[model samples]
Target chain A: MTTNHNQIPITYLRPAKGLATLNLKDLWDYRELIYFLTWRDLKVRYKQTVLGFSWVILQPVINMVVFTVLFGQLLKVPTDGIPYPIFSFAALLPWLYFAGSLTRSSTTLVGSANLISKVFFPRMAIPIAGVLSGIVDFVVSLIVLVGMMLFYKIIPTWNLLMLPIFLFLAMLTALGFGLWLSALNVRFRDINHLVPFIIEIWKYATPVIYGATLIPERFRFLLGLNPMTGVVEGFRWAILGSKYVENFDPGPLFIVSITITLVILISGVIFFRNTERTFADII
Target chain B: MTDIAIHVDKLSKKYKLGAMYERQDTLRDFLTSMVRSPFQKRPVSDNQILWALKDISFDIERGSVIGIVGRNGAGKSTLLKVLSRVTDPTSGIGEIRGRVGSLLEVGTGFHPELTGRENIYLNGAILGMKRTEIEKKFDEIVDFSEVAKFIDTPVKRYSSGMYLRLAFAVAAHLEPDILVVDEVLAVGDAEFQRKCLGKMSDVAEQGRTVLFVSHNMSAILRLTTETLVMEKGRIVKRAPSNEAVDFYLSSGFVETGERIWDVDEIPENAAPFSPKALRIINEQGLVVNTIRSTEEMTIEFEYQLDASVTGLRVGFYLMSARGEFIFTTFDTDEPQMYDRFSVREPGLYYSRCKIPADTFNEGRFVVGINASTYRIRRYFQDERAITFNIDPAGAPGMQWPEQRLGPTRPRLNWEIEKK
Candidate 1:
């Protein structure tokens, strides 16, 4: 059945001859969906609970207290003359956001199996929303961090404005890793058990509870290899200022962090694009 | 735009039959396969692949309501899936010239925990509607769904009928250039189904391309301009709606004792099950569709399982030719029989049951096969599978020319008493 009706645009579906299809334009078209899903996740997150949104602040606050007790009192880990609570809270702000985003984003595809199979949208949107939703929790916890910094009387300087930029880096890091994990999780379920363990091990490698000075100067350069190192130090510099940054070079660490994050994120996008086509069949 | 709204060029999809569970794309799977390579003898081709769509090609015009009809597993869903881009084709191309809206399932993104109001936006976004577009259609969608009162309530609290109504309402208002609907109207009560049919007809009349796949023959006859019959992954025939339904229904009924299913007659949805033959046997064990009513006869259904499926109970329902009430029985209906074949292996199996003498009236009876795992699940059921006539030559009723009312014609002992 054929007729000459010159109205609708032609869309061709065929075997795409390529290693991957980024389809960034399609992603751009469906950008509103990403916003709504992220909003939905944030709205539903704290519903019908006694503590409700307090859980957001309570998680990092409680973690900061535990680290102060163990690392500060028991192990006596140096904080480079900065108060341990503020130091830990400052670093924990970005660290918890990274961890939370990583956990949620990695499972976003698996969680929405019905949507993936039944609807057509950029598959990347689901995981991106997972990372975006955590920003709300991060913003809430940052307020609590500000309150704690006031208690210690260590005022933030010009570096305070760069907190969101560092937070964006953390988001990119989570998304970079999450893109790989979410796409991989669609086929291999082993990623589910592997993520929590990765977060646990990853937290200590960064200077969340302790200061960067705890690691020897000889091995200090190696610490920058961990992407979170720059994020944590970036957060510290932004909130606590360089006086507490302990002569650490923010320039080189920032460059290393941005470079590595970009590489991982771009590669993650390519990998996700490669495997997304078969998600419905496997899922 | 092209003259053809949609052009399908040699569209095909190949799926590995039994290895679906073992389908692995991870490094662990690769490592295991490499580790066992030296010890293994079976080649990769040993994993049999079923071509769900095999070089099928067609062209659909703009603003035409086309219906796809076939027995289950005739690759109808696969065709829709390929067109909707749910899964990519193995080797083919389909040029769809329009903003296509496919309703593969109602409530594609409805979260049970979310309120109906929230779900409208969520489901709309998933359906490719922008925020501004949904905001504009918000009132229209709410009014159409008839859930305006409970739009604030969580959808999990709504009755399933209400949920489906809301879902269908959102989908109805899509107004895409081309609409692909697959059995979505089968939900809800008769009245709602009628409303959906009316709405679908309105959609077709509005000069939008539509591809509808349904088993409801009457609906197909009502709304579709033309129909395509799919059998075993290929379009076997295409004609106007009425004639196509006639050919589709009549092709299943044969005038002989043994009905041998041809390749095209076997449905595509009958995956893992390829029916071989269905036979009617007399007391002496000879196949016969027409048998003496006073003698016992057995009906046997033969099929082969391409993959091993668990808890499969293959049987049939014996009904009258005019589609009256009848008994439904499965192979695993008996206690011991259920245990014996609880886990079915990949092989040929025959389910045969004997019916007592004088069980049917002097007319034709239909045998509808049911293949499922009891109430837990149902795989396939062909209600009008085959028909056979009973010749009551020497029965008690043969002396008189009276027509019986019900399905059974029995010779019960009764004596006339002086009142």
Candidate 2:
């Protein structure tokens, strides 16, 4: 066995300093762990509940109903001539996925304190798993959106291909903020209290309940800075098609949102990597 | 170079004391500190920094089994944590030449909500085993745990013994070029413990380097050839297991004749009954670490009470070097004395017991002190508090050149009635 020592890989451990590389190869090597952990999160999510998977669909549908009543009926909020139920329900799918992934990812590090402190793996897998586990919920809720689309007699178009792209964008945005908040949550438990509040305020800022046209033309760029603005608007555009909504273009808004998301994500990975060494000690 | 499995060079780790309290772990406290920093004149003190491991260097060859022995807080766990990469060292470097599997704890990532089968995979992955590897060894692991029937049941529903066995079984199957283990044997029953030991010996037989840390002297002596004795934050002695265990058992305390309790060493719950010191006095009335087997010796315990304690008994347990209990004696063992001192007053007191002449054989003896109110509360206990050696030259066995077997050699009258 000693004769084949050259074939064995060596790992040198030293203190991390300054900015560390993202080490994506390490993440690639542990891809199976990411899968197992994501599987675990999905399996354990609704195990004992009576409603089980129904809660996934009910959450968005119930929110869509309340928004339709408040904005569509009494307030008479415009949906660009698209039916209020289908319009808002389309946006709600991505928004709820983003919110759910964000909340779960931010708490992932603290929640898996045992794994972090006891074992060595790519720490990034934890939050990534957190973001990935929400996809089942997103896909399940998308079925309800399809049912609503059928009810509204909306025909599928080439724009339907863009749904996955926008959903991926939503996942990236959640992962970006999730990495940042989860790493911070280890040292400052205040992040635990702060995440839900952020989600609550972030929902009203995005165009989930109403159309993006509600934002005045001049301040639309400000809306685009919220990252999810583009994702939600893009989801509506992709599913409802350009003909359903009036003069709604996701071009400039996507540029702004994608740029912000990439910046957050790249920097979030850097910050998380730098602080990863101290997590076991502090957490 | 190929033979060296691990090379640790001047590695050290420093931890800030009261880290959670001193560092702002909350946003409110952090922001407040940030706002107040400009006006604050004093910097943080250096005394709060503790070097858990200091400038330690060692090299272990492949296929060698090494043991680490130390008292609690002596950096045994810290060293293992650093080598296993659970935490980073403050300075220097450690190079490993092969895949490392560390068992700092058993079933580290086991989830109560997951079935035992699910946990095996999760825990195996967490311990650095591949999924296919786990799948291949799945049947062997389940058989080892003896929980095949309950493999699908959530681990929370399993009995505690079954839980521990399954956890250890998964850990036992971890095949890595180098293995790092802590006090995992401290759990499980005696029979299960023997099985774990057997499995570990098998791992050792496969020519893998093993770093084992345990307080069980017998386990260390049996499994390891070379042992490292640690004190404070550095390796003070590295020798064969016999010499290392002897040195550790004899000089591990603050001093040989007496042990003075430090304020930090005493837990807050000890409360009203605070121990001051424990001492061993000889016939000449001098504190000593060695005495003749024929000479009577006194074991004294001094403590102070802030409030009166009812039914308080102060006693000491005498054990041989192998941790076998010889006997336990209390200051109030006599019924008359128990009645008189049933209620210990709020003041300092000394409780002493004498071992009669010809009581002990020629070997090292350990004394452990305990103070408790019967069936109510245990004030304090310091097991292995102090150790002393006995010389059999002056005892009844001096005429025979052969050593006596057993912990004690008593002088008893024998009559030749058979003839």
Candidate 3:
């Protein structure tokens, strides 16, 4: 936008001599492409399906209902003070957003092989677009969480203002792992099946179905190692308020999770940039 | 400002070939190969490393259109890929000034699920156009594609021709400082192909640099100022369009008696049928270019059918210098051979036939080849493939000969007794 010239010059391309070259300027120039790709993805997501955008709301609601019947009713998992459905839905919302985006982002490179081999663009745009497209589903599913809260007639405290921070943290956690999975998937497609398995296992470890205290106090920190663990708990605490979640504080877990998330996210980006040059050749 | 729009220097790309490492594309293949690698020993020479491009360099002045002509696997696509940055070079570097739009294939990212209107915007963005730019040209693109009536429909339902029309239309409207186009014209029907060629020529006339790669020599002759001929991973000659086309066509046919097919030149579709070599042997059993008109000659066609092919037939077409068809003969034309080999099993086979003395009339003759099954499929056919010079000065009728006009000069015996 700031350029005086009509056309941008495409400079030399060669084998990297030292560190991986990240064409931040090209990415910036093509930022609109990312938006369009994300927009295209959002539109195509719901096309031709009878359910359409309802699937966005339906996915979390269906899983939450299943969890409530199994964990909240059949076994009667202790839920501190708040109702089980609201508690479960709050956690499930962020968990699904994180899981869905991660799964989609991991395969984005291989999925867009046609684009990668033919046109010149910032390769990072593809997975980033994939991760960004999940925002629509995230916002849509958030409405269901609010409806559940009204159904339970629960009034939130001032801690509700902190929900945005938890949402940002969940996005960070999702994008961090999404970057890693998507790049790895380009080479070792075994990562494709592995991503779903990890997400499935990660859901249980993150306390999405049951409350956070379900983990024994000694091993609770171990759960925080999975970044989504702190995110899910942070969501529950922010939505249900501090008093509702007993026997645990989400503050320390959030710190640990955020640190791990940033570490993974940075390394994921580095690895992706490193392996991107070989994608067209190998894929 | 420098006038050079593109400069590639000492560029090279090496590819390792082997079944084991030939693009272990799938993770399953990688895992299985990993599991099997330590057990079986692989010879060091088993994997042949080929340099797709070798220290090649070229430059294009601004506002000039250049064509690259090459045999398949001669590194034309590799050079384009390197220029497009789809894959990194092994060693050298290439500098491209100004905005470079590359169409490696038509419709790089057109999702079939998206409607035509949405796909245009998506494809424009994929080619690095901004929203405002695409919006400015949106109507022009729609009109040029001539699919405005069906613009709202998903492209998957459109006939393939319509799909290509929309795809090529988007590419044509992409206004870049430099354009790189490959064999995208091969996809569209003839009329659409002409439309694409016209659009490319229009772009060229706008004083933008263009790099075109195609097998259509007529298109090259009409559009390009200069052409680069590549052979064996190197640019052998760069000249004006006519000279380069002449060099490409005539250089490989100088050796008349035998023609050897390189492993890389054989097409993949010619799968079960691979032609290895073809030669003509004189009466003395030596392969030679010139043959006496009265001497018997043998035409030998050597090829391999790796897999059993039912109804496999090998044939040759003999033609005159001006492409006049003299005769077409097939190996299976013999009545007795009908049941002798119904299905060709996996093996190397040679089809050779002897021509009696004085079978050819004079000058030079050409031999074309056809390898296929009757009414089933045609694997490979090359018309006017190779030519050989024939000498008739020493024939039986040489004393009274001026010029004979026919495919064969048969020397028939006549009694001089009064009848």
Best by lDDT: 2
A39-130, model 3: which lDDT tens digit per residue? Answer: 98899889999999899998988888898899889989888866788878888888878877887788877889777866767788888887
Task: Record all residue pairs in model 2 with backbone atoms less than 3 Å apart, i.e. clashing.
Answer: none
Per-candidate TM vs. native?
A: 0.82, 0.85, 0.80
Interface RMSD of each: 1.8, 1.3, 2.3
Colliding pairs, model 1: B72-B269, B73-B268, B73-B269, B74-B268, B74-B269, B257-B289
Write one digit per residue (lDDT tens) for candidate 1, span B201-251: 889899889999986666788889899998879998899988887777666
Per prediction, the TM-score for chain B is 0.69, 0.75, 0.66
The residue ranges of model 1 lying beyond 4 angstroms of the native Cα positions read A1-7, B23-27, B34-43, B252-419
lDDT assessment of candidate 2:
0.86
Fraction of native Cα contacts reproduced by each candidate: 0.70, 0.70, 0.86
Q: For candidate 2, write residues B339-392 as lDDT tens digits.
A: 999888899999988888899989888897889876457788665678888978
Error of 3 at A230 (Å): 1.3
In model 1, how large is the Cα lDDT of residue A17? 49
Q: List runs of model 2 lying over 4 Å from the truth.
A: B20-23, B38-42, B256-319, B323-362, B365-404, B407-419
Residues B1-419 of candidate 3: C-alpha lDDT, one tens digit per residue: 54788898998887655422444566777567778895775454723777889988988988899999876667888888888777888998889888888865766799989999999999988887888989999999998898999999999888877888898888888898889998786456678988888999999999899999976667788889899998767999999988997787666575669987877667556888988888989999999888888788888999998899988788898877544567889988887775677888999999987878778888877788888887557787655456787888777678885776677878888889986
TM-score of 3: 0.80
